[model samples]
Target chain A: MIVGVMGPEGSYSEKAAKLWMQKYSMSGSELRYFADIEDAFLATVQGKSDISIIPIENSIEGSVGVTLDLLLENEAKIVGEIVVRIEHCLLSKGGPEKVRVILSHPQGLAQCRHFLKKHFPDAELRSTGSTSHAARLAGEFEEMAAIASPEAAECYGLKVLLSNIQDKKENYTRFIVLKAGKKTLTEPETGSEKCSSSACKTSLIVYLEKDRPGALYEILGTFAKRKINLTKIESRPSKKELGDYYFYIDFEGHDSDALVKDALKDIKAKTDTLKILGSYPAFKTFRSVNIDKGY
Target chain B: MIVGVMGPEGSYSEKAAKLWMQKYSMSGSELRYFADIEDAFLATVQGKSDISIIPIENSIEGSVGVTLDLLLENEAKIVGEIVVRIEHCLLSKGGPEKVRVILSHPQGLAQCRHFLKKHFPDAELRSTGSTSHAARLAGEFEEMAAIASPEAAECYGLKVLLSNIQDKKENYTRFIVLKAGKKTLTEPETGSEKCSSSACKTSLIVYLEKDRPGALYEILGTFAKRKINLTKIESRPSKKELGDYYFYIDFEGHDSDALVKDALKDIKAKTDTLKILGSYPAFKTFRSVNIDKGY
Candidate 1:
């Protein structure tokens, strides 16, 4: 099996991929890295990689717009999810006094704003393509430091200058695993299942038939009447015009389930467009090291 | 009157402030620039500025998480809104061939990714606090170019090397004007109006009384039954734990309106916490320069 993620390597996406593998007791999977989230998804669709793990949202930053947009545009099916706590660390080759420049992915740098403001007030902050790439740069430059995962520090032979540097301690990111396939409206066959799990979730993108008052409320009513729990709801611009949006919703049931199917049917009747992104198993807790801990 | 905004004088926030001033036909308002959005909001809360124009959401990028988070934490009230189209330009002191480094706010750089990849694939990309700040640095460095607004080129004495470099053409950002005040549930008195508008919108942060199934669906039922249109709905992590979230919602209608008031009453009765961000006039279209048009 091959897993695709945004790279160089040692990024949070990789960490989530590893956690996903461990949780499912899967081994011998090769990890492939791409330059961007869309590229990772594309790799899966093109059969270059079997699956792609991509960050969908973050606790502090909210949704990853690119991932959401790409999901809407691509044919990949979400097969699983994993939530990883983000712990940013300041990694460097030299001590704090020796560092004059800081490098990181933009989000990584923003997460450690307060720590950097107080300690590296004079350092020049630069954005890189990925945290691991920043780590590589930090390792190569004596006067440069990087804000990244501890795994990145170890991979690049860098020392942790500061740990748990993010402003919010409870920061977490939700990642979704995507496979290239058309999602079926029916549930998977239980007896001859290639991959199946209990506790399923169904994701959908619903567009209103018309721009009318209470349209969304009526749609939510479909699920509410059936006592279905919605895990997430977010509005994304349709890119056609202002005020036009495509609602992304995640609910707690597989499409094959009777209750879920009825609700989706009602929603389809009311909505102008309804696309089921996929139904996959809900995320369960898994054990992983504190990423903030220094190597 | 004084208006605070994130700036180096040519940011989209500054443009929105200018547009707001023009729409209200107000004059003699000093526009003050801050290094960050929070500082601009703080200026209003601390009485340093009468109002602050802050970007609430972008069509392509979605909500500005920091702005939403800060509004929830502070006592600022939304008073007005303005939408500005984002147009990115590649500005530099030297020609495109001489540019070795590109700088801009992370969003600006991301928006122009396609342009950069096609034209300057080898150039190093860096993130800055503001697009105008990137323009300033680009002006100072002969080998550096900035992906910024055309206004920044004029302000920083840089030449526009390329225009309309963003990947998307319909990119627009919505900015809200905030004041330091608590919103009253009652409708504003028309005769003794200190501030009032005809078409209004009320924004709120709603927290469920408990994590019950269909809790959100029930809440939407309140608005749905009232035939109220929800402009937006998003769930932000409550920072308490996983699955716990605070729903940020914007709906058409003033809190003073009878139907809106009744919906709020019902929502408050069922919610654990309900905070009214404020009621303000719905956004109206305004004429502004196309950002992609080169100087």
Candidate 2:
């Protein structure tokens, strides 16, 4: 199996890919790194990779708009999800006092804003393509530092100047694994023996029939009536005009379930466009395992 | 009156401030520029500025998460809103061929990605604090170009090498004017003459009583039952836990309306926390005005 991810080799995305591999027991799978999220998705669609792992949302920063946008436009299905705790480390070749420049991805820099402001107030902060790219650059310069993962420091042969430098200790990023093939969805099964063995999540995008008053209320009513718990809901521009939006919603339950099918049917009747992005098992949070511990 | 905005002078916020000044006939009001969005909001809260105009959402990019986060935490109320068309221009001191580096705010650069890739693929792309700041730096060097508003070119004494270079031509950003004082909301008036003179929008954040199934359904039911039109609905992590979220919803009709008042009363009964962010007149779309034309 081949897994695609955004990278400079040792990015958080690469870490996520590793975590996902361990969770699914897909050891010995070849990992391919793409330039960006879109390219990773494209690789899966073009059959260059079996699966593409992409970040969907961050605990502090919220959703990744580009990934969401690509999901809406692409021909891939979300098959699984994994949440990775983001622990940023300040890496440098020299001591903290000698560091005059700080670098990381824009998000990495933003995550450690308070730490940087208090310690390296005079450091020139710069954004690179990835944290690992910053780590590689920091390794070459004695006066430079990078905000990245501890794994990145090991990868780039840089010493950890500071560990867990992010503002929030519980920061996490949820990544969805996407595959090219679509699952076969049937008319929801109605039975006392509910297909609830695995906690399932159905993600879909809905466009209202018209920009009318109470349109969304009526659409959301379908899921509300079915008592389906919504995990997430967000509005994105329809790209047609101002005020017009397409709602991306994630609700609990599989598409094969009775209530979800009924809800989606009712929702489709009211919406001009209704695209079921995917159905996947909801992610369960677990304590971070030491990656350095050999499995 | 003094208006606070994100600085470097010739930014889209300043342009929106000007439009707002015209809309309210508040010309001759002093415009104060702040370093960031949070600072602009702080200025309003501190009485340094009477009102602060900040971008809330872009048609293409979705909501500004930081602005939304600030609104949730701050004491200010949204008084009004204005939508400005985002027309990016490539500005430089010399011709396009002489440009070796491009600079702009991250969003500005992302918006003009296609134009940059097609024309100046080899140019180094750098992110700055503001587009006008980039324009200022671009003006100082013959080999530097900035993606900014045409107004920035005029402000920084640079030439517009290309106009309307954004990936999406219909791009528009909605800016909300926030004031320090909160409005006292009352029950919707029971009168034959409804206060439907202007299209109004009510923004609020709701935290459910518990993370229960159909908790959101019941919340939406209040609005659905009243036939209230929801313009937008989004969930942001409560920063407490991964699954815990606060729903930020925007719906039509002022808080003064009878149905809206009834809905809120019911919603408050069911919710643990209900905050009425503010009610403001909905922005109307209009053709882009020539900022260069004399007022």
Candidate 3:
């Protein structure tokens, strides 16, 4: 199967996509790169890519709203998940002192803002297409430095001026693998029952009953009553009128579990629109680190 | 009161600060411009500014996570709130037969991404410090246009290629006014008893009880049972450890109100920590319009 990913080449999304291929143990998997996440989604939707991997959220950065919005807009189902540890570094050509401008992705820039303010407050912080691009530029220009990955510095032949520059040490990003067709895993096999997703968690996109006040309370109450643990819950504008929203929720158990099955029944009763994005295993856990080291 | 805002001058934040000053009918309010929201917060904390205004969330874009993170980091109280309408424009140097690049702030660039991709499929989308900065560059350079405010276009002497170019027409941004100290306005000689905010609102930061199952459920149950309507609820990283969080909540009715007072008392009983921010009247309904129309 061909896995579509976002890139300027060697971006975090691309790295996450590669890790996903390895985790699935898919041999000889073809890779396709798109300019942005939307392009990757379109490739999957058009059957150009069998599975598409995209970053959905980060621990330090919060939700990737555009990715969530696209998942809701496109009818694609999330068939799997992956989480990758993020490591940032400062790369420069003529060393740190010679650097007049620092470049990185907007999120990368924000993550390193404190470090930059403390060290190089007067230096201009420019936004680039990706961390990889920033590293590439840092390597090419004498008066520029970039906040990126150590791998990126090596790839671009730049000196690593500082390592682990992120504001938070346990920086991790959650990515989803989307497919156009119906999910392959069914029933109990969707959870740990199957070797494919034995350690995986499940995510759901649900819309609640609008006319009833406390309908959302009742819907969340179902999960609470069931003792089901939720990892995340984010609300997005459903493009409907004001006060209407689509709630995207991530939980520990798969749909086939008795508790989840019962919660779905009560949730369906209170929901106006409910769609299952997919049921996949959670990504591998990354160990936490020092926030100061990340920058 | 001295108000701190994020701007180079004539930015959206400056406009919002002016509106806040007028609402309080406080004349000759000093406005201090900062590089970003965090800097403004620091200014307030250091007694350089009495109040700081910053955009916290956008309807189309969801949460501004950095602002939320900064709020959690600094010991500042959220004193008031406002929602400003956002209207974006496309400006250019008059003779652009071939537009190679379009520039905007990262947030603005993200907001208009779909439009840019559809219209200029091959053109590069660049990021700048702000919309006003983009317009200034576009005015000085020949091969560029900018996505910014119409007033920005006028101020920088750029031609308006398009107006209201944003994908969504109903785009609105919710801004939070923060301060180091909490102050309350009660019905007094200058105000009438019929004032809407005499029975004000209260914002709080609460940490959930323990890892016990259904703990948050029980806490939310109290609000539901008491018929308290929640205006907003968001989770931010506690940073003490991975997976721990603090919930920021906003609801109608002051803490002194019978129902709300009971709700707070119950919430505190169940949660690990509860800190009240402040309560004030919402923004006066204001209609914003295009620059040529003098809104």
**Candidate RMSDs in order:** 3.7, 4.6, 4.3
B-chain TM-score of model 3: 0.83
Off by over 4 Å in 2: A94-102, A113-125, A140-144, A181-198, A285-295, B94-100, B113-124, B187-198, B285-295
Error of 2 at A150 (Å): 1.6
User: Number of the top candidate by TM-score?
Assistant: 1
lDDT of 1 at A99: 95
Q: State each candidate's clash count.
A: 1, 2, 11
Write the residue-wise lDDT of candidate 3 on B1-295 in tens digits: 7999876565667667776676666677899888766687778888989888887776666667778777766677776766666788888886546577788767777777678778876665665656666787788677788888777877887888888777787666677788775433222212111224334556777787336556656766777887776666676666544345677766666554667778878887887677777665544323332322212
Q: Compute the lDDT of residue A167 as modeled in candidate 2.
A: 72
Candidate 3 deviant stretches above 4 angstroms:
A182-200, A208-212, A239-244, A284-295, B94-98, B121-129, B182-199, B209-211, B240-243, B284-295
Worst 10 residues of 2 chain B by lDDT: B188-197
Q: What is the C-alpha lDDT of each candidate?
A: 0.79, 0.77, 0.70
Q: Name the best candidate (by lDDT).
A: 1
Candidate 3 lDDT for residue A284: 39
Residue-level lDDT tens digits of model 2 in B109-222: 766756776787667666566678788889889999989899899999999998888878888888888888555575332211233524788889998643577787778878
TM-score of each model, paired residue for residue: 0.91, 0.89, 0.88
Top candidate when judged by DockQ against the true structure: 1
